[model samples]
Target: MPTTINPLRYPGAKRQLVPYISKLLTNNNLAGSTFIEPYAGSAVVGLELLQKGLIKKLVLVEKDVLIYCFWKCVFYHTEDLCKKIEDTLINVDTWIAMKPLRDIINPNDWDILELGFAGLFFNRTNFSGILRANPIGGIKQASKYKIDCRFNKPILISLIKRLSHLRDKVEINWDDAISFMNKAKKDFIREQCFVYFDPPYFGKGEKLYRHFYLSSDHRVLANFVRQNKHFDWLISYDDDPYICGLYSGIGAKYCPFYLDYTVSSGKRSKGKELLISNLPLPPVDLSMTSSQY
Candidate 1:
C-alpha cells in the first residue's frame, strides 16, 4: 500500500469528508470493488481508497484538460516530476520566494498545474494553502493571499511512497463520462463497479468555483444514467429543484446531505446536497452506530 496521500492540499477538494465518505463506503460494502469517479476533482476520495486497499482499481475520469494531464504525469513520471521540482529549488527559500516565476508558467500547461514538483515547494511555506485567487470577474484585491502548502519531509516521504502504488492502479480517461461508462459496462460485465459523480452545482456564483462544467452537461449525464442499466452508482449534487426533477424516476435511493460551506463565509449554511444511489444502502443509523471512525 502507498503512504497517506493528502488530497485536502488541492483547492475545492473534498478531503475533509474522507471519514464520512469512507464510512459511506463501509456501510455499502464497497471495499475491493472498482471505484469510478466521473468528476475526479483532486481525486481525494479515490486516492483515499487506494491507500486503504479498499478498492481494487480506481477508474478516474476528469474533463479538465490541465488536471487530467497533471495526474497522468504523476502516474507515469513521478520521479522525474519530483526531480524537476527539486532541481529547480535548493533550500526551499528560492522555491517559495519567487513570484514572477510562478506567474510566468502558463495555466494551460499541465506542468504549472502539477506544481507538486515546482509549485508545492512554494505552496507549503505559506498560510493555509488554499491557492485562492479572487473569483473571476470579481474585484481585484490589492494583494493576493495564499494558504501556502508546506512541503515538509513527512509529506514528501508520503507522496513518494504513494506514487509507486498510484502509478500502477490509477487509470485516466479523456472521453466524455457518459460514453466511457457505456463502454466500461461492456468490458467489466461481471466486475463490480461503483460510480461516484460530483458534478457542478447550480446557482453557485461563477467565481465561487471553476465554471468549466456546463449546466447542460447535467441533463446529458442524467439522461445517460436513466437509460443505462449497467452497475450500481452514487451521485452527489446540490439539492436543487431542477436536480431533484432530473433524478426523479431514475431508480436511485435519494438521501439528503448537508454541505459544509467553509469556502466562502466559513459558516455552515442551511443548504443541502442530494446523494442518489442506484444500489440499496443498509439502514445504518448515523447517530447510534459507531461506523464512522
Candidate 2:
C-alpha cells in the first residue's frame, strides 16, 4: 500500500513508451478522453497518462487479486503506507538492494510497504513480472546479492515522485478483461473509449504466471475485437505471422516495436523483443523527429 504507486516494475509494462504515447496524444490532440485499459497489469500506461494530464478519467481493470488489493491500499491508505515504507527503509541505498520477492513470496510479510514493494519487485525482477504463484516460473533471480540502499537516494526520490501525482479519477476493477471489455464496449459510447491491449503471448508454452492469461482466452478476445469494428483499440503482441494474418483482413495495421527482455530462461532469452501493435504503423516516410511531435 502506497499513498502513491510507482510506475516502475510492471511486468510487460509500457512505462518506457510514455514519451511515444504522449507524442501520439499530442499529435492527435487527444485530451479529456476516457482512457480505458482492460488488461491493466500494474497500470504503467494509465499512471503515466494521469501524470501527464492527458486523460480526464481512467478505467483500469486487472484480474489479479493481489494487484487489485495493492491499488486499493494505495488509493485509500497511501499516507500510512508511505510512513511505513519510510520507516522500514533505514537508508535509501540499503532498501533498493533488497529483492521484491523476498517479501511477496513470504506469507508472513504483509506490511503495506512490503505489499507495495512486492508489486514493484515482482514486475522488475520476475519473468515478465507476470505475477505467477511459483518463483521457479520466473525468468530471473531478484538479485545475487543485496545492494546497499544508503547510496540509492535516486531510487527513493523516484518512487516518491511517482507516489505524489496520483489521479483522482481512476476506477479500478477486478474482472476478466474480455468480459469487462465486452460489457464496457456495450455500456459506453464507441467514440469516447480507447483500449490498449497487452495480452499474453501465444504458443509461449506453459507460463510461470499461467493464471494471468491463456492462449484460448486470447483467441476469444481477439475475436471480440475483430468483430467489434466500431471500437477503437491498439493491441500489442509478440511478432507472430499468425497475428499478422489474423489482422490482415481487418483495418488494423501493424507497427513493430522492441521491448527489452530481462528474463532469459525461455524462448525469448535476453534480447530486445519485437512487438506488433495494431495502432497506426507510423507513416513509413516520416522522420522520427517529425513524427515524435
Candidate 3:
C-alpha cells in the first residue's frame, strides 16, 4: 500500500507495463475511456493508470471471492481497515494465526472482516507478495528480513485512504473475465471502453498463482477478443507456443515484448512475453523484463 503506485503486492505485478499502457491509451485516442480489467490480481496496472489520470474510470472484475472481498473491504470499509492495520501486530505469531483466514480452498470474505485482513496480511508478508507462497525469509525467520519488512502501516493506510476516495471512479466486480466481457459487449458503446486482459500466465502460471485459466477458457477469451476488433482491447501472456498459435493463428495482431520478474531473493530475471491486441502497440519494450489472456 506504499508508493502511491500499487496498494497491493503481487508476485506478478505488472508495474513495468504501466508505461506501455499509457502510450497505448494516448496513441489510440482512448486516454479518457473507461478501462476494464478482468483479472484484478493486485490491480497494479489499472490503479496506476487511474491514479495517474490516464484513464477516466476503472472497472475491476475478479472471480476469486477472497480477493474481491479484500477489495470490497479496502474501498467500502476504509476507516476500519486503516484502524485494523494500525492495531494489528506484524510478527510471525500473528502470521501463523492468520493463515486459515485466507484459505483459497475455503475462502470466507465475511466473518468480521478477518478474512479480508488475512488476505492483505498474506499478500504483504508472503514471498514476493504471492498469497499462497511461503512467508518471507522462510518460516524459520533467520534471513535477516523480518516478516514485517514490507508492511509499512502508515503508508499502507495512507494509500488505502487515498484510493478509497477514488471509489467514485472505480467499480469492483466479482465475476469471471468471460462473463464480464459478454456483459460488456452488450452494455458498452464499443468506443468508450478499453479492455485489458491480464489473465493467469499460460505456462507455469497455473502452478505459480492461486487462480488460473485452463486451455479451453483461454481459447474462449482469445476468441472473444479477436472477434471484437471494434473495441480496442489488449491481452498479454508469458510467451508460449500454445498461446502464440491460439491467438496468432486466429489472425490477431501481435507484439512480442519482455517484462521483468523479481524473485523472492531480490534477484531480477528476464523473460520474453507476448502482447496480443487489436490496437497498434506503441513499441515493444524489453525492460523490466514482463500480463494477460
Which is superior by TM-score, 1 or 2? 1
Sort the predicted structures by lDDT, highest score first.
3, 1, 2
List CA RMSD, all candidates.
6.0, 6.8, 3.3
Task: Please report the TM-score between candidate 1 and the true structure.
Answer: 0.71
Worst 10 residues of 2 by lDDT: 284-293
Off by over 4 Å in 3: 1-4, 104-109, 264-266, 285-293
Q: Write one digit per residue (lDDT tens) for candidate 2, span 129-234.
A: 4454323222233444222212133454455445444637888887778888777776666456666776766545245343445555766876887788654666
Best by lDDT: 3
Q: Which residue ranges in model 2 land beyond 4 Å of their true spot?
A: 1-7, 11-13, 27-29, 87-130, 133-143, 147-164, 203-210, 265-279, 283-293
> Once model 2 is optimally superposed onto the true structure by TM-score, how far is the C-alpha of residue 79 displaced, in angstroms?
1.8
Cα lDDT of model 1 overall? 0.58
Query: lDDT score of model 3?
Result: 0.78
User: Which candidate do you rate higher for lDDT, 1 or 2?
Assistant: 1
lDDT of 3 at 259: 61
For each candidate in turn, the TM-score is 0.71, 0.70, 0.90
Model 3: how large is the Cα RMSD against the reference?
3.3
CA lDDT, candidate 3, residue 175 = 82
Per-residue lDDT of model 3, residues 48-160, tens digit only: 89988999999999876667777888888889888999999998889888886655544443563676677788878888777778888778899988888889888888878
